[model samples]
Target: MWNKRRRHFESYPEIVIVHVSGYGRPESGGDPKKCKRGCYDIISQAYSGWCKLASTPEHEVYRLPLYAGNYVTALFGAMEMLVAYIHAQKTGEGQVVDVAQFEAIARIIEMYYTQCIITLEY
Candidate 1:
């Protein structure tokens, strides 16, 4: 007989967990060099597309005021996790995961390619 992992909580509920627990320097105001080109725009489009595809009912979703805000939150969350993992691996205190901005953006557009390929088949 196979054993299954125990559920953390009974009656599992759907939720969006944005994990942003890690250390890093916050961006200073009006810093041009601190910003990355086209990254913000890409993330915004990805986030909006994600929200649109979410299974939750419209009434239950909390839409962000601006797509830029969503992008920043997602970017920060990814950075936090990546930094923590890197710190841990170097010091033998944590695991490291390499998440490049370009790769992440490419993953977000996987469906776009699928759509392009599939639509032509019809």
Candidate 2:
């Protein structure tokens, strides 16, 4: 069982387990770039695009206030934790919450496409 400190306790009565990660399980000496990009290529994965948006084209990278991808992923992580919390209240069973930034952003982009196809609203 993981905790807010980002460590797993791995025992019963696990109150809260939140895994907020940029990439899937950490590996030894992996490409720092690839870990950030992950398996999907979405706008949230576009570091260059994000930098361009923030008006800092000096390099392909810049420190933004929100860090959009991580921020959104963390929000999703909180939502997942909330759902798990509600379930725990009902069933008295705790579960781990694994949330990946790339996955969240990819899902968000996918949902946008889905909405565009279904309603052509945007």
Clashes of 1: 1
- In model 2, how large is the Cα lDDT of residue 107? 69
lDDT per residue for candidate 2 within 1-122, as digits (tens), equals: 12433343334554666766665444323356655654333344663233333344465454345566776787798899999999878877777677766667666567556665688543
Model 1: how far is 96 from its true place, Å?
7.4
Lowest lDDT 10-mer window, candidate 1? 1-10
In model 2, which range of ten residues has the least summed lDDT? 1-10
Q: Which segments of model 2 are wrong by more than 4 Å?
A: 1-14, 26-44, 47-65, 112-122
Q: Pick the candidate with the highest TM-score.
A: 2
The TM-score of candidate 2 is 0.53
Question: Positional deviation of 110 in candidate 1, in angstroms?
Answer: 0.7
lDDT of 1 by residue, 27-50 (tens): 222225423334444454443343
The numbered model that scores best in lDDT is 2
RMSD of 2: 7.7
Q: Estimate each model's TM-score.
A: 0.29, 0.53
In order, what lDDT does every prediction score? 0.40, 0.59
